[model samples]
Target: MKDVKTRAETLRRTIGHRVVDGKDAAVVTVSQSYPTDADDLWDACTNPERIPRWFLPVSGELRVGGRYQLEGNAGGEILTCAPPKSFSATWEFGGGKSWIEVAVIPEPGGYARFELAHIAHPEGDHWETYGPGAVGIGWDQALLGLGLHIDTGAAVDPSEFEKWSLSPEGLGYVRESGNGWYDADVAAGTDPDAARARADRTIAFYSGT
Candidate 1:
């Protein structure tokens, strides 16, 4: 297993707010640079065959305007597609709809940065209780698998990773991810004490405490 502290620190998280279709929406962005070119990185993200090796098993017509679904997860319409660059889609799950944008940015030395932004409108007190750590930490976990796959060229056993998430070491990584999101929320204008409280709860939720 990878070191919890180092793996948790690999991704960068951020929080922001905006109006989407006249409703106040919160944006949670988690990004990390991968040791690959833009095309290869994009292929890993969009290819159904490769995605399941790291992320969830996905099935659907994966093209612009087509709908796709992740196994036991979100399903949504593909809004736009620009190969090797970015894609935008609707994230539909649990009767809630949100927007997601993913970008693959090329860096020098053939490196690429993968960025994903999930924007959701808070209807209840969910935002207050969980904050960005709610989604930020989840994405961090998925991206960690992506990093492992890219680095080692080996498929991560889904069952193993799932079981690991409930283990002691996994909980440590989850907590560290939550801490990072808490700091990001504070940097984005959330009150420190309040954000810390939310982060604690969010950490517990993911860690099954």
Candidate 2:
């Protein structure tokens, strides 16, 4: 992978709480700047053909109110779209549903900012057990793949990622990312010790250890 350790540190993670339709929800945000333009970055994100290059094989209608399925992953309806800027979609998987928004903003320094926000109302003690790192770490890896694709025009092999994620370097990257989210969790008023414990469990879960 392209500087996996650097990629883990490059991301900014934030955990925020909100009231979503009478229920408490967590909003996990991850953003990173890449050497690309907003239009290209937006295309890489929303285009079905390009998505599989870095993320997953997606099959869906590319319009508002259309349904999209990300192979073996989440599937949901496109809620809103503004093209080359931002979009909102439902994230339905694991028998539960949440909301996700993607924003591509052009920075002044010739880079585009890719920001993803995943908002969910966790069931039971799921948040206490896994914390934001549960999803934050996954997004870290996905964005890293996007960065690699943007830099080298290469497709990131999913199987290779699965194998690399268990390797030493991968574990290190995962640990760093989980801890970063742990810090964000603490900033969001979670107990430090409890958040650290959750980060550990999340790392172990993702690294399959």
Model number with the top lDDT: 1
**For model 2, the run of ten residues with the poorest summed lDDT:** 1-10
Off by over 4 Å in 1: none
Predicted candidate 2 versus true structure: per-residue lDDT over 7-107, tens digit per residue: 88879889887998899899999999999889889999988878999999999796899999999999999999998899999999989999999999999
Per-residue lDDT for 54 in model 2? 95
Candidate 2 collision pairs = none
Task: Give the TM-score (vs. native) of candidate 2.
Answer: 0.97
- Provide the overall lDDT of each model, using Cα atoms, as 2-decimal numbers: 0.92, 0.91
| Tens digit per residue, CA lDDT, model 1, 1-209 | 76668878878888888999998899999999988999999999998999999999999999998999999999999999999799999999999999999999999998999999999999699999999999888899989999989998889999999898888888888988999999999999989999999999999899777
lDDT (C-alpha) at residue 95 in model 1: 96
The total of clashing pairs for model 1 equals 0
Deviation (Å) of 46 in candidate 1:
0.4
The per-residue C-alpha lDDT of model 1 at residue 179 equals 94
